[model samples]
Target: MRGLNDKVTLITGAAGGIGRSLVRRFLEEGARVVALDLDAAGLADLETQCAGHAGLLRTMPLDITDHAAVQKTVQAVHAEFGRVDVLVNNAGWDVAKPFVETTPELWDKLIAINLKGPLSLQHAVVPLMLAGEGGKIVNIASDAGRVGSSGESVYAACKGGIIAFSKTLAREAARGNVRVNVVCPGPTDTALLRSFTGDGEFGQKIYDGLKRAIPLKRLGQPEDIPGAVAFLASDDADFITGQVISVSGGLTMHG
Candidate 1:
């Protein structure tokens, strides 16, 4: 939490369940936050929900898959704030289905939103960090990426790519004092998670099985995620980079 006071933090998917928690956590840590989401209405709602911290928050509707738009937004943010101290790549989308049941179109969409979107943000923000006071990047990946998931083959692939990407970027940016890390959440109780239940019996089965298998006996809550994310984004983590931390409650453990 140290060195975060008045720091500019940019979070994508800022309107979703976990995203909202991330925004609130940063704001509470005294960080100036820019909340980006394609859901304008959700962003507006987020602003209302964080009314007490209104002065510290700014909401922007962004489609991260749009390279030009991403560049423009990053430039605009830098122009106004002079620097971006933290970046949280929390935007992602997925569907629960067997790999063979998925189509090429689905694959493209998954890749673009989950992988390319974060890369675009990195491309735009890393340069600024390199040129100015360095920054921290916390990417939200999934346990599905570390171990595999039965029905999320493509999504898992994208997240695995994120883990690899973050590690490589951290190595490249360390000289500039830029830190990049990943937070992999296990099954979290979020709108996205609920959506899977509606997909069919397979989805429901996966959800139920996850709850039973988790050593903690319950799905993760959105609020459970921020402490880890905020820590990784703060001066306390200055010595940490290129590492992946799982937020899941014993659902998946790795050395």
Candidate 2:
């Protein structure tokens, strides 16, 4: 793996499970990271956790769904770091309910967070990447998007849209030396998973059922994801673009 020494990386949802893992991993790899998330307290906690690594990490609290806020945050990142070489669109939200129960309000929220957020981030960052001559973008999608999932109709749809958007953006941006790709994590052990499955015994039962179906016999850790993100964001994946790599512990396969 190529070292990211001095590289500037921006990761949205940086206060969340997978996002926080990615931020730490990238910093460990010697990159300067701009961490963006909606959770102010979480972001502050992460800042404290990474305090010893001065100049290596900067936390920005922002709502990705807000276009103006995203633009401002992107600008601030560039101002702080001078350039952004990697953009990880890792922020997302979902609602778990039967398709019949999914109202338009819920549908809009899913799309706004999962699809539009990434779109907004890309809009705000790509030009900066182009201006800097090159960059990488990795969208953290889900296997639920690839194969569909119960109680995640709108969520799946939004994720699927991310996959499609990444491909198109990859093709369009290649000439500018920008690479775009998607990482589809399957049933990861994240706060979002807990929220989706509900509380206590009921959640454990649902998790256990999913675990039994996965060939790896377990859920993935947030740590399991950053390696793929790091690889995709590094020179090692320079020739790779418009691809979907499933980090799902063999939970799903695509030909």
Candidate 3:
């Protein structure tokens, strides 16, 4: 879209399933992107994949939960690109265990990666956005947060927290010309999902079950997420903020 043309966008968790899709989509839209991920190898792969795109892509291997590192990276982005016009906080980790089985440490890790990571990134970027004209922020939440999923208690809690955080941030940032929103994605065919299932048989069963539950009778793809993200990040969504739009296949309709 014209909204994203020539813009500088930063995507956290850029090496993951949906994250990589977002990087590719944004690049195709003519946006220069800074792709950040904890996996150095994945980041390298992304760099290789986008090699021909040249000036359109920059990869950063980062742990988003590290506040100092996030700040440093963000500052570097500003120095390099002059401004960050759009930010997609898409990096997250999940622990699929019952609430009783979840240790305090495990809980903390989930909260740190899912909630605190976004908080830290926002703190680092919002001031720069204020100094600039305006900016867009799209947080990748989950349907689990909207409708609780079994074996993902803490993960759901963190995602729910992100939704709330985005709403409040939207209100606070609006006056500064900054727009914030949330995109809740359904079960997608991602490496993370396969990990949750553990093996071929179990993974197939899980996918089948999810497909049955979804009204569309199919699972989402990584490609399904980025279009919504790109929309929210674009000027097309300038008037839309504090909204939680689900990208599920009519799995949970809250209205």
Candidate 4:
């Protein structure tokens, strides 16, 4: 919450769901935001939405699956902002299905978006953070990754990989003053979730089941996420690194 004014933040998956909330929160906290997403149209829409926010908003059309492009974009962001004070790896995609029902194609897409995407961004950004004294990285993983989910085998795996990767990077980046951490959301209400559950009777059934299962007796909202991310990205978390915080409303209590 502190030391965030005018800080430059680059957020991936900035056009949807939790990504959208993260962008809004950062800007509201008086931090400049560079929003990156595959949906150029959505990015443009977001810019309009944040028309008069306390801080500025700049949108870039990005596909995190491409390493070289991501690297190049990172360079451009640094060139434009002079520095990236925070990097939130929030871009991800997944399809709900059992592991046995999943295919290689699905696996590739899942890995590309959820896991490799963050890795590529990190590869490019961490060095720049080191050169600039330090920066913060908050990766959005999922509760599925932390404790597994019924219909998200591959998605869970990718998120699990993200959690592991964050810890390892946190260890490697600490000396360089770059802090890495992860925020895992439990069955949150997002477009992705809707797509996963569908907009039909079955979807409603699935949604109800999840809500009943969570200890808080409800699904999470987009707004529920950004506070944790904002904390990690701000000086408030300067002493924190390699930690995984789950905003699942008591869904998975892992000690």
Q: Against the hidden reference, what TM-scores do the models get?
A: 0.97, 0.97, 0.98, 0.97
Report, for every candidate in turn, its global Cα lDDT versus the true structure: 0.96, 0.91, 0.92, 0.92
For model 1, residues 1-255, the per-residue Cα lDDT tens digits are 898899999999999999999999999999999999999999999999999999999999999999999999999999999999999999999998999999999999999999999999999999999999899999999999999888899999999999999999999999999999999999999998888777678868878887999999999999999999999999999999999999889988876
RMSD of 2: 1.0
lDDT of 3 by residue, 16-110 (tens): 98998999999999999999999999999999988878789999888988999999999999999899899999999896788999899998899
Task: Provide backbone clash counts, one per model.
Answer: 0, 0, 0, 0
Q: How big is the positional error of residue 134 in model 4, measured in Å on the Cα after superposition?
A: 0.6
Worst 10 residues of 1 by lDDT: 195-204
Task: Give candidate 3's TM-score.
Answer: 0.98
Q: List the residue pairs that clash in candidate 4.
A: none
**Candidate of highest lDDT:** 1
lDDT comparing candidate 3 with the true structure: 0.92
Which residue pairs in model 3 clash with each other? none
Clashing pairs in 2: none
The CA lDDT at 211 in model 1 is 91
